[model samples]
Target: MSPTFTMSAGRPAPLGATFDGDGVNFAVFSEHARRMVVCLFSDDGKDEIARLDLPERDGDVWHGYISGLRPGQKYGLRAHGPYRPDEGHRFNPHKLLIDPYAKRLTGHPVWNDALMGYRADSSRADLTFDTRDSAPFMPRCVVEDPAFSWGEDIAPRTPAKDTIVYEAHVKGLTWTHPGVDAPGTFLGLASDAMLEHYTKLGITAVELLPAQAFLNDRFLVDRGLTNYWGYQTLGFFAPEPRYLDRGRIAEFQQMVARLHTAGIEVLMDVVYNHTGEGNEMGPTLAFRGLDNASYYRLMPDPRYYVNDTGTGNTVNVDHPMVLRMIMDSLRYWVEVMHVDGFRFDLCSTLGRVGEGGFDRGAAFFDAIRQDPVLTQVKLIAEPWDIGPGGYQLGAFPPPFMEWNDRFRDTVRRFWRNDPGTAPGLADRLTGSATQFDHSGRPATASVNLLTAHDGFTLQDVVSYDRKHNEANGEDGMDGHGENFSHNLGVEGPTDDVSILRARAQRKRNMMATLLLSQGTPMILAGDELGNTQKGNNNAYCQDNEISWIDWSQADDAFLDFTRRMIAFRKAHPILRQKLFLHSRERAIDGLEDLFWRRTDGQPMSSSDWEDPALSCLCVELRTASGTPLYGATETAIFAVFNAGEAERITLPEVPEGMRWVWEVDTTRPDALPGACCGATVQMPADAVAVFVTEVQP
Candidate 1:
């Protein structure tokens, strides 16, 4: 016989299963639910021991406390109400639901017809309610003891200007690594071997794709694939169980601690815009079962959901209860999980207010800005969605950095020798001041990235012109068709010496541009070591070797060059300045902060900027009294780009008592240390070179 427990009235202020010294308090919010029942399972979570009705109703919240109930107890909820889809009420007590604020979950949902509230084979479809018990098919929410000895675990708190984000997926990053003892797990990512690699890469933070618990799509499962990118969130508070091999939530905390110990901040890529529940016809998971109208943005017709994220139902962040849940989840990650920051995925949807319009002064933004703990953490926004007015780049409020896609496109077109890209490239290299310079937002507000997880890797950018996403189970029509890539000569990997050499040089040029550019730089993991997805730009479902980082194929020379480039950026504070250069002299020094020039070493004129044929240009960064914009005095550097045919760039005149020394050249196999140049320098086609001035003391 299962152990029975007595209950008492619980407070509804603190939602979810909160464990006190005596027992656990269970609370959930469902304004439209007529009845709510909490089901307790056996220790193994297979047998339902008892069912108790939440007798207390404080406003929209139903809550109750169970004495003698401790941590490790498995439970779920069942709400009975109207199942009218047209009226936007999808409550069905037969379908068990996980707690919206579940700190930990016991199992992954086994896909079955019983898990759905609507009958799959019915002619009426979602209108037909199925009374099958989904308890056996669903995961049980665990009443967890939120206590861990986070000894000396402090946030790294890396400065925004100093942060170099390395985007990585936990499992894909270390699953195939030969050095890691615990592969495909959080412990493996925190292993000494992985930490050493990140340290060597010179990235201050690791922006993990998504760690929140998500559901596996039935389509992918049928095709022998999985959702490799954890964008489909199930439980916002629970860490994905697959990532924890042994220690569960404690293992995730340990990972954070280990990363912090290594001086690297952990920034999670969070998806609060939507849940895994696809559409009205989709599975009745936690949110849809508990309260569909309040949890999801319903259409005026009330039968369909507002699909803002392009993934079925958009989250109704405008609702008070939903907003509270999101805020609570974010705080939980920062305070309990010890994460340093968050990168909001498809963030435009979160800022949408009533009437389904994006608002700059949205309540979500205000809540974060007003929060004491959240305001201190680094906040980044993906800044776009597929909805109306969703392409909101550089429009976020203060302290919220946005991923600048214009920078990526401009850089790609410039290197590809596309006409009229020089001016755009110049703007991007200087932090895209056109987009982010307003509202007193600094240059750091633009997170400049040449490539990210959603697109092609640096290697594939020069190796394949078209996306080969056949492996994704979708025909060639899946990923972005306009990848802004070039195949050099051959389509895929070729042993041709000329093509290989050209591709390597192009990769180096792109990497140099990304690192040397102003604003925060984000390096896609495995890009420095020349990791490729073979032409599979969108490998969201290919969770095998197609997505894993192949350490054996690591390019040591390229990795060294990348490391040196990062070091160079760090050495020169001007490269990563917080302020956007306005071509004005600094207060400390009388020299102009930055200068844009044509290949002839003259300042770019209006006609030059408007010229469609111009492809090559030069940028000069100067120091005032040997001091950069932010840090201590550093050497002034001049960088030149030659995307056209090979040309001789007349080196700009150096300051008095100083000479130009070549520091970096993309044409060479490695960074070259050359003698002082007098006037002119030779640059190969589609290459970039850097020269720093030496002061004669």
Candidate 2:
């Protein structure tokens, strides 16, 4: 009766909602569903266009082909089965839902009570179903043509070791920059001038914050703010419509192409762990309303969802059909969107299994490993979540890089004047081999960061002791308590020269540690320019000037200093290493390439390391063997860190036949200066000195 054609149900080989341009083909793989129907929505979403009952049923797949439809059509699904909460089944057909295979989403969902599958005010949620058509409030899936011509533009293909990543939010990066006319949007980022900024900064890749279609929570919108961070993703495949300058979805793809031509790789921070559809009491925008049981991993009792990500709903990554949907979206980005890599937000959720534990051999992990296209691209993992055993820092398998929290904490503490932090500081400066050694990964496996979008900028890390998130409207309860941060002397801004000097030196010391460390360092946007969120670590809700990068506010001095620091790191080899170091082995001859010494030019004693007042350490590195670590070649360098007040540091004696030359000094008279060699360099207090010692010919 609903204009259905008789076609044999195809094999369940290619899974997910796939459209072939002729008509919409609905296919869902649920080994236990009793019935699955495809629901169509009108343009206004007030009336149901049609409900085509899936007549054909294969082994575990329910699919049917229908004609008289083209790309850009909107539809959803309603799978009905046993409503047994105790058995982990929550099949409700009353709430209209989204097709998991949707290639593109039309717009963001309108938050309302009608979008909820269960009565909002009721005590019992899944027990009593609310017979409401949620189509009016939910976003619709658009049939995409999946065709684009990317003429001559290929991924930058920069290897892991050679690549320098710049982590930035699309809107936040260029939002307040006066040069960018269209501030706080996608077009601003794609502009040629913005690309030039990165090119001049010497960053090879731009890891953008989530650009996927996301939701601004009802509470956030009501408070006159929104989820400015974009971590709470709603649709994996669709770009956020608000980000697009033009209505065409292809504009997002075009941005990637433009970046590629400039030799800059584009990596997306994706959230597959959770969706905007919150809990049983939350709205049913897409997956929840269509087939709650099949799309989500409900608790053994169906009334509740297992909140692993702390975002209300956890996607069933272990589900075969749902698993394929994620993989398909990933491939689409690489093949269709032309993205170079992905940084998985709360990646631990993707590795979860039956007992609600993270399984290394989860279906999602295996799928990515096996996919030829995906395997070739860069895959980075945030590597942890709120769930049990979620802190899988260096536990990820090969071809994966993880954020090193230990490195971040240690570096922060050492530079913050914390007592007895020397030993731990050295380990982190060498790339935290203790965490990543056994994983058979290179030194670059650890993606070191002193600051990211979730925390304070490098400038704030040395100027704020506590989070000032009152602006976020969370009563200052949001963000992490243990930030491992320290304000030099004053809690916030200060006119005291002593406090200001301490903050500047702390910044220099931390930057030196990050750049000199043997790993891939990801510099947060605006960090080099001394950007601050006014101590607001969790500015996820502040979409105003607080979150935007004020390019105009950046001084010439800060810009020059940042450029020199980046250039100095790129010019050295001892900083980046492919293999972890062996403490016993001499790097060249009888003398070790790396020598641990005190500020007195003597071998460091255990007691010296234990001293809380010990304010300085020397790291001497020799790369004379011309050994190559990734793309960086050989060079000898020495770094000295003084975290104390203005005091002349007794310079360590240069090795025989080698003269120490100052490559960079944090307290230089000018922001950018030439290297000075073979002199008693007046080391400024609370400053970092990088001296290059080359072999005399």
lDDT of each: 0.88, 0.77
Q: Write the per-residue lDDT of candidate 2 for residues 565-602, one digit (tens) a residue.
A: 77777776567767775555644454455667666567
lDDT of 1 by residue, 1-697 (tens): 3446776898896999999988889899999999888999988999999888898999999999998788899999999889899999999999989999998897688899998898999997999989889899999999988778999888889889899999999998998888897888888898999999989889999999899999899889889898889889999999898888973788888889999999999999999999999998789879998999999999999889999899999999989999999999999999998998999999999999987578989999999999999999999999999999999998999889999999989999999989999988888988999999999898999999988999898888999999989888787888898989999999989999999988888888889999888899999999998999999989989898888889899988899989988988887777888878767776655657788888878888999889998978788887545543444324578998778888888887866877788888888856466556879988778888888877645
TM-scores, all candidates, are: 0.97, 0.92
Q: Candidate 1 — which residues are off by over 4 angstroms?
A: 1-3, 584-591, 624-635, 669-671
Compared with the true structure, the alpha-carbon lDDT of candidate 2 equals 0.77
Clashes of 1: 0
